[model samples]
Target: MYNIHWEEKALHELEKLDSKVSSRIFKKVESLKEGLHLSDIKRLKNSDYFRLRVGDYRIIFSFEDNTITVWKVGHRNHIYDRI
Candidate 1:
């Protein structure tokens, strides 16, 4: 299983979401500990980070040394803007 490390920005974004939505996202992210073979996960083009889609939100993260570091989290429309 991979360890999860949340970056400040990602955590902040997640905190801004509705409780139900945030919990749902958290569960999905936690599920990554099993593996990244889930259908919602995909590698970002021309980038080292991978993205996990959950509902209309997107999680930007990278995995290394058995750790998954979340860099950002936001709505699909704006998640890629600053990445």
Candidate 2:
């Protein structure tokens, strides 16, 4: 199982979301600990990072060693813009 680590930016973004939405996103992220078997995961083009979809939100993260570091969290429409 990979350990999860949230960057300051990602945590801030998650906190700005609605409680229900944040909770759902958190659960989905936690599932990554079981490995990327979840169907929503996809690698970003030309980048080492991968994304996990949870409804309209997107989680931008990368895994190295035994850690999954979440770098950003935002709505699908805007997430890619900043990343």
Candidate 3:
């Protein structure tokens, strides 16, 4: 299993969600740590970054070695030109 670390931005966004939604999202993210495809993740471009969908929220992260670093968590309604 890969280690998972959440950035301050992700943690902050997580706090904005209701307990049930937040818990479910966390579970999905943790599940990915166990084993996820690089093909699925590589779409994020360089730095081994990726984004996972959880309902209306988006999880931006990166995988390095045996760890996953969550960079941000945000609603789909927002515009993020980070790409």
Candidate 4:
């Protein structure tokens, strides 16, 4: 099992999303605790970050030492800009 941590900025971004979208995102994050692999995850070039897709939004995170740190959450258009 991996511990999931959310950066303050990521949490704030989530809070600004629609409730339904937020709920789905939460569910997907929780699934990471159950041992999800990185087969479908897209790695950001030249970075330690990876991305998980949830509908039109994206979850940007990094994994290290049994911990996953979510750095940002936003729609596709602006998510990469912040990263």
Candidate 5:
């Protein structure tokens, strides 16, 4: 199984999201470490990375070595507002 790394950037993103959605997003991240690669992950570009849709929010992340690092989490309309 791969290791999941929650960078301060990602953790901060989680803090800004709704509780239920945040929980679900984390669950999915954990599952991915266990080898669940869905269409969403498969569709990622080499430089683009993976993204999961939680309502209108997007969980953006990437993998390095055996670690999955979540990069950002934000609504479809608000993602660009981050950073």
Candidate 6:
């Protein structure tokens, strides 16, 4: 199982989202601990980060040494800009 760590910015972004959306994202992230691999994920160009798509939102994260570090969470149009 991999450990999941959320960055402050990502947590703040999640806080601003609708509860339903935030709940779904949180569920998905938690599922990663069970060895679930999201087929919808995409690796960012020239970076170690990968993005997981959850409806209209996107989760940007990187995995190393059994830990997944979430860097940002936002809508599809704006998520990439900040990363």
Point to the candidate with the largest lDDT: 2
TM-score of candidate 2 against the unseen true structure: 0.98
- Compose the digit string of candidate 1's lDDT tens values, residues 14-59: 9999998899899999999998889999999999999999999999
List pairs with backbone clashes in candidate 2.
none
lDDT of each: 0.95, 0.96, 0.76, 0.91, 0.76, 0.90
Residue 8 shift from truth in candidate 3, angstroms: 1.6
Candidate 4, 3-83: lDDT as tens digits = 999999999999999999999998898788867584657899999899999989999999898898999999999999987
- Best-to-worst ranking by lDDT: 2, 1, 4, 6, 3, 5
Candidate 1 C-alpha error for residue 9, in Å:
0.9
lDDT of 3 at 12: 88
lDDT of 3 by residue, 1-83 (tens): 89999989789889998998899779988888769853434346554567787777777888788988888777767614543
**Candidate 5 C-alpha lDDT tens digits along 15-78:** 8878998888888778888774675554355555677676677777778788888888778787
Worst 10 residues of 1 by lDDT: 33-42
- Cα-based TM-score, every candidate: 0.97, 0.98, 0.79, 0.94, 0.78, 0.94
Mind sharing the TM-score for model 3? 0.79
How many residue pairs clash per model? 0, 0, 0, 0, 0, 0
As a whole number from 0 to 100, the lDDT of residue 13 in candidate 1 is 95
Once superposed on the true structure, which residue ranges of model 1 sit more than 4 Å away at CA? Answer: none
Which residue pairs in candidate 5 have backbone atoms (N, alpha carbon, C) closer than 3 angstroms, thus clashing? Answer: none
lDDT of 6 at 50: 91
- Model 3 residue 15 distance off true place after TM-score fit, in angstroms: 0.5
**Clash number for candidate 5:** 0
User: Which structure is stronger by TM-score: 5 or 6?
Assistant: 6
Off by over 4 Å in 2: none
TM-score of model 6 relative to the true fold?
A: 0.94
Q: CA shift at 56, candidate 5, in angstroms?
A: 1.9
